[model samples]
Target: MNRMAALRQYQKVNSQAQTAVATPHRLVQMLMEAGLDRIAQAKGAIGRKDVAAKGVLIGKTIEIVGGLREGLDMEKQADALARVDNLYVYMMKRLAEANIKTDPRILDEVSGLLTTVKEGWDAIGDQQPA
Candidate 1:
């Protein structure tokens, strides 16, 4: 192969290896960011005692969780992802209840749950995928 062709091939292989090395860390970061965003929105809505706003945030939270699940391979991370999914669903329900009753407690509960999930994700520390 010519020099240019060999350099291009080398770059391609390097790019693939980089992606392989980064995938798990990227996934964890994405999940953590989503969870943190949801928690922040929920907290803001609760602070304002806005039922409609809380409902909207809850809907977004559900979407984020669903997206996380879609990006993940269930066979590889089924247990952890399942648990996170369940917590997300539960948070949605709590948000709905808070909206109906304008209860700030529900928001606090969901925020705590999201915090726990974020901590768990941090603990994984870029390790190999489960």
Candidate 2:
């Protein structure tokens, strides 16, 4: 195998190992981090006028947000979680718009929203034993 391909394989294995041992809270944290990273990369792709990369990155970010939404406890329809679910839906819509327009402002808006959510999650993590 080539050096870069081997490195990617190693990183994938390492990430899987970390996920296996991570607590539930940490898993959510990691997901949020990944979503934010994808959004940032998508914004960069927009700056570079890389339409293909922007589409793929935004798509990944949408999937990450969707996963986070799916993970929410919605059976009881708790007010707070319901609001988060709504926010995720909104983020996905904006992501689609951004992809079509190649707009960085929309990306920035989504990034800020996700960062706010992540900050709240991190605060909760600090209070919980993990």
Candidate 3:
């Protein structure tokens, strides 16, 4: 196989190994990190006027955010969590708008919001009992 393809296969195997041993909390962290990375990549695509890459990246980000929302236990929802659900919905909408408009600024807005959520989530993880 070519070098780039070989590298991708190695990365895929490594990621699968990590996922197999990951705690639920760590999985969520990974999802958020993936979303952030995709948003950054989408922004770069926009700068390059790479419409196809931008669409694909933003779509992946939307899927990641949806996964995060689904992971929430809305059946046992606290008020704060309900608001988080709403924020996720809002983020998805903005992401769609960003894709349609090819706007990097919208990606920036969504990235900031996701970062805020991630920071809070990380703080909660830090406070977890050992």
Candidate 4:
């Protein structure tokens, strides 16, 4: 097989394996980490003046944030879920603003906010019965 085909095969198999093993909590943790990673990379791309890369990374961050928002359980706790939804929306807007303005500080703000959210989520996971 060609190198490109081999890489695609590997990725497909790896993704399947990950999905087979992932619990809902693990998936949420993965999404949060991915979002934070993308925002950090976008910040670096901004510093390097790589406009295209910055835009792409920031776009991924926005999508990841939106996905997280969609994952929230609206029926569980209305107030808390609404707050998280609002935070996710704010993060998405800030990510777009950062991409448009090429601002690292805005990415920093988003990253910090995500980190706090992740911490809270993890704490809840810890308190839950296995």
Superior candidate under TM-score, 2 versus 4: 2
lDDT per residue for candidate 3 within 76-123, as digits (tens), equals 747978999899999999999999999889999999999999998899
Alpha carbon lDDT of each predicted model: 0.57, 0.79, 0.80, 0.77
Best-to-worst TM-score order: 3, 2, 4, 1
Weakest 10 consecutive residues of candidate 3 by summed lDDT: 1-10
* Clash statistics: count for each candidate: 0, 0, 0, 0
Q: RMSD, model 3, all Cα superposed?
A: 7.6
Question: 64-99, model 4: which lDDT tens digit per residue?
Answer: 777777677788889978988899899999999998
**Tens-digit per-residue lDDT, 9-115, candidate 1:** 22332222332344444544554465457557766887887767777766666555444444455466678767766765676677677666766677677767777
Cα error, candidate 3, residue 17 (Å): 6.7
TM-score of each: 0.58, 0.85, 0.85, 0.84
- Best model number under TM-score: 3
Residue-level error in angstroms, candidate 4, position 85: 0.5
Error in Å for residue 11 of model 2: 12
Runs in model 2 deviating more than 4 A are 1-17
RMSD of each: 11.1, 7.5, 7.6, 7.6
lDDT, candidate 3, at 112: 98
Model 1 vs. true fold: TM: 0.58
